[model samples]
Target: KERFISLTIKKKQQDVVRFLEANKIEFEEVDITMSEEQRQWMYKNIPPEKKPAQGNPLPPQIFNGNQYCGDYDSFFESKESNTVLSFLGLKPRLASNVVLQLLGQVTVVQ
Candidate 1:
């Protein structure tokens, strides 16, 4: 059972990383296993309502700088809804805007 949980956590973390990379979003991966400080920071930053009732929240917690974005499940939901940028507190770039930018036809107004 423990092994299964470990594999599941790795898969979720990989999914999050893959999504971020595919979108060209810059991110830092923290290894909580290697750093107690980071682990505690993650735990401390998670909101009370988001914590699991039985144990410390698992890995794949998303954050934008110091702000807690959400866990993997929340990330997956936002991805499915096509709101990942907003979910990560990022400015959403419309598909049309991207095409225009590629062609140098217009400047994207933030």
Candidate 2:
């Protein structure tokens, strides 16, 4: 599958401030801008589904040599550490078969 994230947002301190200032309806100066309460007010007005979820949700992130890294598959399963890794088709990268145990049970990965 695809690696980690579907969307990426990068922000720098001053750049974010400048962008916010530019978006402000009547503000030409970044110094005189909206307060936190004002921004929060705007956010609260948005619908629940329209509101931000605030996290990355992606699947089966594979690295070079097809090494997949993710936590979605961790739910519901109880296999031995090495056995779990073997089941996921991760025989090459994991040395000494160190499968990270979860819920005091099944191994997570190689």
Give the top-scoring candidate (lDDT): 1
Residue-wise lDDT of candidate 2 within 1-110, one digit each (tens)?
Answer: 12222221112222322422353411122110235442333333334553338832222111112232223233113132434334444454433322221111222222
lDDT of 1 at 85: 79
Please provide TM-scores, in order, for all candidate models, with all chains considered together: 0.81, 0.21
Which segments of candidate 1 are over 4 A away from where they belong?
93-110
Question: In model 1, how large is the Cα lDDT of residue 32?
Answer: 64
After superposing candidate 2 on the true structure, give the runs of residues whose Cα lies further than 4 Å from its correct spot. Answer: 1-33, 55-110
Q: After superposition, how far is residue 6 of candidate 1 from its true place, in Å?
A: 0.8
- lDDT by residue (7-42, candidate 1, tens digit) is 887787667767766876555444567667767777
- Alpha carbon lDDT at 89, candidate 1: 73
- For candidate 2, the TM-score is 0.21
Candidate 1: lDDT of 15?
Answer: 78
